[model samples]
Target: MGMGVMRIPRSAFIWISLFFITLILANYGKLVADAISMNWLVKYPKVWVFPLKDYVSLAMQWLVEDATFGLFTFTEATRGLSWVIEQPYNFVRALLSEGFERGLGKSAVQVLPPLSWLTVLSAVIALGHYAKDWTLAAIVGACFGYLAIFGQWDSAMITLASVVIAVPIGVGGGLLFGILAYRHHWFGRLLKPALDLMQTIPIFAYLVPILFMFGFGPVSALVATVIYAMPPMVRITTMALQSVDPEITDFGLICGCTQSQMTWRILIPSALGSLMVGVNQVIMLSLNMVIIASMIGAGGLGFDVLASLRRLDIGGGFEAGIAIVIMAIAIDRLSQAFAERSTSYVHPKIRNRIYHRHPRSMIVLTVLIFSMVVGFFIPMYQHYPESHTITTGAFWDDSIKYLNINYFDQFEAVKIFFLKSFMLPTKRFFIGIPWPWMTCLLVFIGWTFGGWKLALMNGLMTLFIVTNGMWAKAMITVYLCGVSVVIASVIGIPLGILAAVNKRAGKIIGAVIDTLQTLPSFVYLIPVVMLFRIGDFTAMIAIVLYALAPAVRYAAHGIRSVSSELIEAGIVSGCTPTQILTQIRLPLALPNILLGINQTIMLALSMLVITALVGTRDLGQEVYIALTRADTGHGIIAGLSIAFIAIIADRVISASAKNARIRYGLETTHGH
Candidate 1:
């Protein structure tokens, strides 16, 4: 399609064919070895001829021997860390115990009573009702009630606690780093690349290094979750703070405000809107990590979902999924309300009375009464002397056993059929193509769409995959992720446009998008795999389900953000609502819709690393294998390759989006 590319003769196909033939002949033995290596028969024979069992045992022995030595080395190095934390833990313990007799009235080692289920539900309903309107109140109440009834209340509470801890830490760290990045030119420059790497690294990659350093538990999970969730907030905060009006700063200076006061009172308050968006992002991402974090011993709904997945228990997984969704919705709405609350108009007279009313006293009085009632009445809420109180033992274990016995019986047949008919056939079709032929096709398509930059990127990415001996696996991954993205955009765009056109419907859809975007991917993966089985189709469905949210959100935002004057012009021209939407609105919102497509691609890529839970032979599978075997070299290379693909796509889409935005005179970034 390009002038330079068009001049090349199609007759070069003969030379291309011959070149591949010669290359294949030259590397026939290597190719045969690789093919044989990957074969289930050659790599894992039935204990004979190859002595597969003996070989596997020997490999396991080698791995365990190395792992034991590594552990011993680490233990020696960190021997003092245990002592350091013990000193602090003991110091606080002694102080609390000493003060207990002097009316502090608390023992450091003793467990306190938890609020009753009824009390907790009542408080949540009250808070939700107070936050927004009656609809929100009902949604909040129903969500928690369902969680409680489904036997996920305790795990849900643990997840809530972790989120509560992580969010504030993420927010604080983000704000600090944001201010640092904003104030120092060199620091910001250094931070940009680090942020890029952090943003693109797979969640599993974080697990290895984190577990290496912090070991596996809630703390390591917290560390990983915070790292992942904090970046967007940092970037947003820096951008928002940098975008603050110069005149406002001058005015604040003239008002006799110190630099610190100006930052606290003027800049931060003025930038609150965008900052709140960052906060919302943090909360949502934290919730997304809940299930992934479970891999590292962060117990909650995430663990339950994982357990259900391993056992193929679709119903149990569905329940946990619902709990995750409910939590996501509640937290998202709360953040949204907080962001909106600052803008609410307060009557001057009522504001003064409300401010003078000593709200803390009322809060303290309510807490005391609630505590008294809960401590006295609820059996399960009282501090238990033994292991049994409220329990979910049979509910979880029986579900797993039932599914293992009966559920996968029918599904396995279908899975085998699909694998034989569709999956294997498609894979062979792609792998049968000569590399040179594939290269030409890629170059031609890339040139047609995005021109030379894309062509160059395509060439480089293809070369990388081929050199790494993963070209076929990469193609399979591309096919699945591509299909998912296309499907998401198909559904999400029109739905978003429709939502944007109606105020009430926009509210309802907006809530759905919020919930979907935040719920953990593993929650969706189980039933998807159960329904479709563990192959490309199930993975694509899972990715599509999550990827659709960004597409819907951006399309809605783009349509709603369109200038009203354009609509009026269309109306004056005697255009119907349908004509306006088709002719005026869509054309105007094209750039933003393209942005939504970009987001869909990124979201789909994120899911690539996750779909490995259902087992794909993609880069994600390699990454997982590397973690299990502690093969850091292979893992890093595979991880970077995935990141390279993402970066290429991200750069192309972002460039195109920027071009469209500039052409349409649209603002690229929003300020507070």
Candidate 2:
């Protein structure tokens, strides 16, 4: 038998494909819907199902029972570890915000004196001065003062205590892992995928296992934050250490330096700049995860935001959100300023200045003494007066009400158009595809972009989703992420280009991007829900806003990173600005732009779990439902599905970037 096919133009083929899909959906819509809605087709057969949830529950029950029966001392071990971890957190928290408490019994406990709020404020100011300059000191003082004035001082301090505990753990573990990966080829290969998985997985995913193992509280939250924040630290550390000049290592060896001495004295000092960037990343990630951590009983400003959202108290939520933003800005600026200062060369004269000559210890001591004396005389120095506290919650609440009432029709129109015209159809198309066909399509694209390895990886991931009975939900997730990314790119790329070409525009746009990036991802849902109401569109809007920063940032970075020599060459060749950008800049920037796209997808996926609260029937909703119901099996699987999708994209995009670099002769022996 002979098979023959008619040739079709590329455009015609695309049109024909769309027509075929529409026809199938129209004709067999109910059947397709039923197949997706029913579990039998996608779910594992009863015999094949593993019952992981029951196993985990049973194991936990047995462990607890054993501990209680003294058959094992699991509880004692956990208690000891918990106590060790809690001590520093509690101490710092009390000093900064809680104030010390001492008593004979719970009912009779009396608050004892602790370090004054003014002392804490002065210490921050001093640290800021030591880290950067007087400007940063002012910023730090102002940020802390705002918290005290807004009556969020305690909540902010609780959050800060967690951060202080978590960042060091994250940075330390990351450095260890990074060094190991850098030293051993096999370990590096093994570590890369794990880091990618960790980085791409949503923070919420980390909370489930932590909650189960540690139970719910600040300890669990700290563990989750560390896990969530560590990958970047590791990747950055490895890259920084690996990027050190070979000549420097040879010189250290020639000087008879041992490995430990070389690492401590030479390697660390030389790589300090890159490592500082990693530190900044760790700090930011820890802050960002604080809110998600709150969901699992980690109380702080994050809890403030979460509680407000639950109560639909927009004013309160906004205030808490502002407090968070202020804290983020303070930390970010201080870290960045310090990083920059460390890399800079200071004049000897300036370095010898009285304040500069002394170590940070002297400055800290001076501030502490002053604060103590002031606190002894002034009661308000110990704590901001409650009567003097200010709030903007009411203003925010009123503003939101006014906007919702005044713009109801406009919001409704946008919601309806987006849902009917873009979201639903795209979602339907993805969900309607046969599981086998979807798997084949993914494999084909992966192979085309990255060869057999990626194809196999993606195929396995797709299989996992299909067998887990989450294909439909995964499709919905894909639809939401895909739409959000497309819209973000549409808005972000052009702005990035504009920013890249103009210095003034870059500064202005960079500030906006920074604000957006630092704002808690959860805060994005509030304003969108206020306008669009609860639905996929609102969720998409939140995801887009949360995800847009990277798109704009990377695009601008990519464009700017293009060699100035190339731009000059274009100019010398009589190329117009448009022609130069199209013919030269964009080509060079494509790899970075693609990276931005990859990041946007990852961010969008991360936001998925949070957006679940706003009503979206996807894998995010599955995870959220599992969390609420304490169904570990379902949440873990659903979260893994999201991770799998992200991994697949990351692999393909990375492969493509590598190929592009090779083609452009920009590939290097060492890469981050």
Candidate 3:
């Protein structure tokens, strides 16, 4: 009996202890409460709060002041760096917008000598054809044509300029760091957590420090976008390098290849598929940050969208949103095609074709030559005429007005029902939890998953939240994310299952998922506000729309990833489809689904600040307020709180997924 007792698994022991603790707390609640109320345990002093925000703000101020007034000359250095960065942006903007300026000062000659509209159109078509196929060419051409017709050429070009600068920097930096991390164990360990923090923190949080360091302008926006987009690139690169075949490495060693030679020729070439995927991710993230980047004076279509949102001009917002969507889709498709092509096996004969041999160079040369000739002849060809630009803003505005007039009562009822029956109650429950109890509960969960280390970490995080006096706001943010995730899961899982089980359904659903994932998250807020009105309900709706794609995607991926042999075994056993799904597929897929949930949660947290624009009393609102008020300390603290929450969720969920994999023998159990 003693031997058996000692042999109990740690998880079992932890659960049993939790049961007893719950019983004790239930039966003698006041006693436990009183014990926890001890000053050392519950009353965390203000002095205990790490004034990270204040410290960061002070450092930034010192840097700026010292650079300006002291001998350090940091400001001069930054300005010089800024000038270098601005050159690309200015050249691109000038090429796309002002064309060529020929005159000096007041008598300077200016000419709208940009590429002809037709020349630009033909260039996209040619590039798309080179990248993918004729379908892609048509799509790319149509998208550019839409921008021209809509008078969005200027803003779109500005965004493209920033992307052109940021993506390469992000991709290159990510690859460099990823290689470093993969090569050195200690560096990998240090880098992992930093990547996690970077990935989780709100976009606005990134802007605060960037604004301080770089000051406000396109350069700061570019820097922030690069930072935001780089983590995934780094993560993917590291994973690709690490996952390179061991046999290949051994073969390289046997062939007397140097480390550098083997890495460059073998590992990197083999990891092209993953590297390209990383590139795709970087492109998507760069585009996603365009709007957020506008917060610090990175003007473009994002600024237009923000202005429209502020003025409550649904039509204008919709137009700009459409432009953004088109841009996103064009970029996403082109990058995806490139990623796909990187891994594709091409015949040497076909590869030698003139177009295929020098696709990009040829396309650029052709466009430039054609544009110079045509632009010199036709003014409209050089610059799209404003008088001819399309305006659908009035149509959207009228439509929204009509809906508001006709459906105000119906919309109000729906809002009231959701708020009263779900949102408010959920909000209250999270906010009403006693801080000490909540902290203890989190600790218990952490202990169950990862022993004392995680428990202590979780406890410290909770303490940080409580002591910072943002418990209520934090809880509200949690509630919003929680509810959004729950609803997303409920809808997404079923849809994912349906798609996984049917080929036709999979194609259609996959397209929808792509659209959702690729569309700028901010775009969701417009239509959501139209239907729900602005409040917690609208914010929740917007978050759900924005965050739902991952749940569906992961669920489908997980289900589809289940082994064919497993399904065959069930069929051989005369099991029904339902039995196969429930007993075999779902159990095996749960880990992947959990991964999706983790992603969904992260995305929801990211959307929090954006949702604040629609009015929500959460950490997102706090960050937004800090931005508007220029309170760097408050913004940083609030953003860090959100990051902490995401980290906690990521750690706990990842541990759970690992355990699930181990139980299924998909992973080794040595760690456990």
Candidate 4:
């Protein structure tokens, strides 16, 4: 293909190829030996390796020293500034343990005991009916009833409580940060990288740091969960607030409202709808963190799920997974109902008690609160505030031990066989390709799909990875994620379109997709391993499953959101349903489909770290190893490698989608 005005010379490309070839040959032996070790170095036995190690060590030490210095400064300066006070970190830990014990202990007695599971089911059903209708009520009640009968009520509650605490904290922090970002441009600029890292850094990669700083317990888990969950809120809040109507603010000011009044009464209320979505996200993400946090000693359903997997008890693990899905659905539906509810003022009617009273929703909420309070004061309900209600560490430990003896050997044997026969060969095939040749292939593919700008962007991304000594691992990640994205696109696009074509299917599929998107993918990993066994195939399968949601969701949305007039136009042309869908709907939705594919790729890569649990020598594994060993140098490099890939994909896809949108006149080109 011919180059654009900005293209590099053919000679430059040739020299670049020669340089990469020489670099590869220099590192060829070591690269092939471990395949993964090359990720840390451009070539082996190089003088730079020692310096890199030292640099990483020095950086970690400095971080530790700095943290220690800050802690000491605060403690010495303030009377109440110990780790508990200065850290106040211990406060959350204590609340999770001693606090829960005292409260639950007291409640256990006075709280009317376990009420028949039927009673609980009835209450949920009533709640659903009151909130929406019979259909929603049925779902809510059935999910709760399933949890109770399946013997997961306590674990589910434990998980719920942590989420109850973490969601508010994350939402509050995110809102605060977001408001700060909006009011101060420099602050937003400064926060951009921190937020990017928080959003893009794999969850597992940060667990080690969280464990190091807070130590293993509920508090560390809470902290990590909050950190992971907070970024989206911050980004959303800022975006939502920025999008608020200026005209409404002007009206508020015209009515003699003060700055604060305008902000609170007008800006905040208007932004409330979008802000609620952010809150929903916070809750979903916080719940999802339960399983991963379990890895570091936070117990609840997540720990149970992990425990079941370790024991190779698919039935038990699957049950725990279902409970998570149920909890996610219940919370999601409740939050969404409130978010979508319309608000209107009504004058009191003549003499009806209901007309004179507050809204029925408020009344119902009050009753629930009153019930909990009444339940709280019974002899069984009071707590001394120092006891934690439940512990799962021993349960998990025993389960792990039993599984190790019974199932681990078989797991290992299968893993070895798969790796030797299938996975290793596939991996080697990709690794055998010369770096320069691969670069050309990627650029060519990008150019064919979009244009030269995309090609250039893709080429530069590959160049960065190769130069940073991350080419091999990057390629491995690419290989697996590549297959997954292709599969996910195939499945998600069709499902999305089908759902879009039918109302009932849309609601059901939308709900399922929502549940899958919000529930932690880690919980699904163990079951996947049991069914498929661990290898690139297993990892790819997991990726495809986890990553499919975006494609389906975006495709459904893209089709459904199409202007009715356009569809009518196709109809007016006497186009058949199939012809309209193919020539108009699909073509128009292509941009969104491409965008979905982009997200699928990013999500697949996010799973890279989690898939390490199944044993893959990818960038995620490197990050995990770095975290385990506290190798900051290696960790930073690996983390950046993932970030770079995500950014590259994001840029190219975003550009292509934008191009499509403009070409189709769905949007205008801003600069041009």
Q: What lDDT would candidate 4 get against the real structure? A: 0.72
User: Each candidate's TM vs. the true structure?
Assistant: 0.72, 0.90, 0.89, 0.75
Looking at model 4, report the run of 10 residues with the lowest lDDT sum. 379-388
Q: Which candidate's lDDT is highest?
A: 3
Error of 1 at 490 (Å): 2.7
As a whole number from 0 to 100, the lDDT of residue 109 in candidate 3 is 72
- The pairs that clash in candidate 1 are none
lDDT of 3 by residue, 204-311 (tens): 876776776678899999989988999999999999999999999899999999989988999999899899999988988998998899889888899988888888
lDDT per prediction? 0.71, 0.84, 0.84, 0.72
Error of 3 at 476 (Å): 1.1
Rank candidates by lDDT, best first. 3, 2, 4, 1
Candidate 3 whole-model C-alpha lDDT, 0 to 1: 0.84
lDDT of 2 at 476: 92
Model 2 scores worst on lDDT over the 10 consecutive residues at: 39-48
Off by over 4 Å in 1: 1-111, 115-142, 255-259, 343-471, 497-515, 559-583, 664-672
Candidate 3's C-alpha runs over 4 A off are 1-51, 67-71, 102-112, 254-256, 344-367
